[model samples]
Target: MILTVHHVTTYEYDAPMRGAVQSLRLFPSRFDGQRTIRWDVAVEGGLRGGNFRDGAGDKVEGWSLRGPVSEVTISAIGQVETTDTAGVLRGHREIVSPFAYLRETSATWIDHALRDLAETAVTGVKEPLDRAHRLSRAVSDAIAYRPGTTHAHTTAAEALAQGEGVCQDHAQALIACARAVGMPARYVSGYLFAREDGAPHEAAHAWAEIWVENIGWIGFDPANECCPDARYIRIGSGLDAHEAAPIKGIAQGDGSERLDVTVALEAVQQ
Candidate 1:
C-alpha cells in the first residue's frame, strides 16, 4: 500500500519567550516493510541545524528559533510505500543491541502488580511469539481505551490500576509486562491508519516492540489488539514514550505553552 501523510504541530505560548531549540525524530524508519518516496520538514522562523541518523537508525534533526517568538510551527509532508511484514522489523539497520531495552524506565517500571499481571497473562504460554500475543491480548482486555484519563507522566502500573488509558499507556503497559516476563521490549512511536472503529487513527501513534530470540523485533499494539501491518508507518522508538517523543525541546522563557497537532493520511491506489 502507498500512503501519503501531512502532519503539522504548532506551539503557542501565552507570554512571548526568548530562544528555543528542538530535537525532532519525525522521519520514518528504514526497513524491509517501508520505503519513503518523498519527505520534507519545515520550521517556521527557525534555523535548521545538524541532523544525523542515531544508533537506532532513526533520523534526528535539530532546529532553533531566535528570541521574542510566541508561536512556532513544525510540519511534515511525505509519501511512503509499505508492505506487510506481519509486525516483524526486518532488514532494519541499527547498531543498538536489543538487550539494552531490558532496562525499564519510570513510565514502564514493572512493579509487583505489573509482574503478576504479566505472569498471569501468559500462564500457559511457553513459546516466545505465543507469549507475546497472549500478553498483548491480556493488556487489551485489561485497559479501556479512554483518552484524558491519563497524562504524559502516567506510568504503566498507574494505568493498569486505573484500567483506563490511551495508546501511550497501553504501549507502556505492554513494555512493562513484556519486560516482567524476561522479554526485551521498548516503546514505538509512529502512525496507525485506522482505529478499532475503522476511523482515521493516522497521527502521532505509539506501540510496543518486543525482541524474540530468533524472530528479532516485532511490533504490537496492545491498545488496538493487533500487530502492525501495511497500514502502519513506524518512525522511531525509545525505552519509553518520553525518549521516543516526536519533538523534544527547551525554551529559554515560558509562562505557559499550548500545543496543537493535525495529521492527514490517505491511501494512494497504485
Candidate 2:
C-alpha cells in the first residue's frame, strides 16, 4: 500500500517574536515495513538553518523566524510505500537499542499506578507477543477515546484515572506500563491511515513499541487495539512524547503566544 500525507502547522503570536528558533520532527521515517518514496518540507516566514537527526533517529530541521515574524507556517508533504507485517516488523535493521529505551524520562515515570497496570495487563498471559497484544487491548478497553479532555503534558496515571484520553495519553500510559514490567518500551509518533479517511488527520498519531528478546521492537497501538499495519507511517521514536514531539522551540522574547495547527491528508492508491 502507498500513503500520501500533508501536514501543516501555523503559529500566530499575540506579539511579534524576535530571534525565534524552532525544531521540527515532521519528517516520516524510512524503515523495514515503510519506505519514504518522496517527501518535502516547506516553511513560510521562516528560513531553514540546518537539518540533522535527533537522538530518536528522527529527521529534524532547524528554522529561524524571518524578520521578527508574527506568524510562521510549516508544511510537509510526502509519499510512502508500506507492507503489512502483522505487527511484526521482522528482518528490519535496528536503528535503536533496546537497553537505551529503558532509561526513564520525565513524562514516562514508572510509578505505582503504572506498575499495577502492567501487572494487570500481562497477568495470566503467556508469550511475549501475545502479552503485548493483551496489554494493548486492555488499555483500549480501560481508556475511552475522547478529545479535548487531556493535553500533551497529561501523565499516564492521570489519563488512566480519568478513564479517557487521546492517542498520546494512551501511548504514554502503555509506555509507562510496559516499562514497569521490565519491558523496553518507547514512544512513537507518526501518521495512522484512518479507515474512513486516510493518512493525515487533525493531528499525528501516537503508539508504543516494546522490545522482545527475539522480535526486537514491535509496535502496539492501544488506542487502535492492534499492531501497526501498512496504514501506519513511522515518524519518530523516543522515551516519551516530549522527546518525540513534532515541533518544539523557544523564542528570545516571550510574553504570551498562541499556536494553531492543522494536518490533512489525501490518499493516492497504488
Candidate 3:
C-alpha cells in the first residue's frame, strides 16, 4: 500500500523571537516493510540552517528564526510504500541497541503500578508475541481514549492513574509497563489511518515496541490495540516520545509560545 503524509506545525509567539534555533525530526527513513519514495520539508518565516541525523538515526533539520519573528511554520510532505509482514519488521537494521531500549526514562520509570499492569495485561499470555498483543489490548481498554486530558509531559503512571489520555499517553503507559516486566520496550512516533472516513487526521500517532527473545522487535499500538499494518508510517523510535518528537527547539528571547500542529496521513489508491 502507498501512503501519503502531510505534517504542518506552526509556532506563534506572544513576543517576537530573535536569534532562535530549532530542531526538527519530521523526516521518515526507509526500512523493511516500509520505503520512503519521496519526502521534503519546508519552512516559512525561517531559514534552514542545516540537517543531520540524531542519535536514534532520525533525520533532523535545523532552522534559525530571523529576528522580529512572531510566527514560524514548518511543513513536511512525503510518500511511502508499506507492506504487511505479519507484524514482523524483518531484516531491518537495528537503529538502537537492545540494551539502550531497556534503559528507563523519567516518564517511563518502572514502578509498582507499571509492574502490576504488565502482569495483568500479560496474564495467561504464554508466547512473547501473544503477550505483546494482550498488553496492547489491555492498555487500550484500561485507559479511556480522551484528548485534552493529558499533555506531552504527562508520565505513564499519571495516565494510568487518571484512566484517560491520548495516543501518546497510552503508548507511554504500555512502554513503562512492558519495561517493568523486564521487557525491552521503545517508543514509536508515526501516523495512523483513521477508520471512520479512511482519511488522515491532524495529530500524529504513537505506539510501543517490545523486543522479544526470538522474534526480535515487535510493534504494538496500545491506542489502536493493533499491530502496525499498511495504515502506519513509522518516523522514528526511541526510549520515549520525547526522544522521537517530530519537532523540538528552544528560543533565546523567551516568554510564551503557542503551537499549532496539523498532520494528515492518507492512503492513496494505485
Candidate 4:
C-alpha cells in the first residue's frame, strides 16, 4: 500500500522578539516494510541547519528563525510505500541496544499500581511475545479511549488510575507496564492512513513497541488493540512521546506561544 501524508504546524507568538530554533524528525523511516517514495519539509522564514540520522535511525534536522517574527509555520509532505509485517519492525537499522529503553522516564515511572497491573496482566504467561500481547490488551481494557481527559504531562500511573486518555497516554502507560515486566519497550510516532474503521485520531498518532528476542521491536497499539500494518507509516521513535515528537523547539522571546497542528493521511491511487 502507498500512503501520502501532509502535516502542518503553526506557532503564533503573542509578541515578536528575537529568535527561535527547532529540531525536526519529520521524515519517514526506511525499513523493509516501509519505503520513502518522496518527501519534503519546509519552514516559512526559517533557515535550515545541521541534519543527520541518529543512532536510533531517526532523521533530525535543525531550523532557525530570526527576529521579531510573530509566527512560524512548518509543513511536511510525503509519500511512502508500506507492507504489512504484523507490527514487526523488520529491516530497520538502529544500533541502540533494546535494553537502553528499560530505563524509566518521569512520564513512565512505575508505581505500586503500575507494578501490580503489569504483574497481574502477565501472570502464568511464560512466553515473552504472548506476555506482551496480553499486556497490550490489558492496557486497552483498563484505559478507555477518550479525548481531553488527560494532558501531556499525565504519567502512566495517573492515566491508569484515571482509566481514560488519548493515544499518547495509552502508549506511555503500555511502555511503563512493559518495562515493569522486564520487556524493553519504546514509543513510536508517525502517521496512520485512516480508513473508515481505522486510525481514530484527529492529529498524528503514537504507539508502543516491545523488544521480542528474535523479532526485535514489534509494534503494538493498545488503543486500537492490534499490531501496526501497511496502514502505518514508520517515522521515528524514542523512550517516550517528548523524545519522539516530530517537532521540538524553543522560541526565544517574551511572547507566549500558541501551537496548532493539522494532519491528513490517505491511500495513494493504485
The digit string of per-residue lDDT tens for model 1 on 185-207 reads 99999987777568655467899
Predicted structure 1, TM vs. truth: 0.97
For candidate 4, the clash count comes to: 0
- The candidate scoring highest on lDDT is 1
Q: Over the stretch 1-270, how does candidate 2's per-residue lDDT look in tens digits?
A: 888888887777877777678888888775678888899887786788889876556788998875576777788888888888776656544456688888887777777867787898888876887777777777788788888899978888889889999899889888888777778888898888773234333447889988877777899988777788887888887889998888888876664777777666555774
Candidate 3 residue pairs in backbone clash: 202-263
User: All candidates: CA RMSD in angstroms?
Assistant: 1.2, 2.4, 2.2, 1.3
Give each model a TM-score: 0.97, 0.91, 0.91, 0.97
Instruction: For candidate 4, write residues 1-270 as lDDT tens digits.
Output: 988889999999999959999999999988898888899998999999999999999999999999988999999998889999999988888889999999999999999988888999999999989999988999999999998999988989899999999889999999999999999999999877762265466548899999988778999998788898888887899999899999999988799999899999888853
Q: What is the C-alpha lDDT of each candidate?
A: 0.91, 0.79, 0.79, 0.90
> Mind giving the per-residue lDDT tens digits that candidate 3 earns over 1-270?
898988888888898877577788877645687888898888786788888776556787898876777888889998988887655666565456776787889988766877887898887777887777777887888898787999989999889889999888888888888777678888888887763244434347888888887888788877666787877788877789898787888776775888888887777853
Model 3 residue 130 CA deviation in Å? 1.9
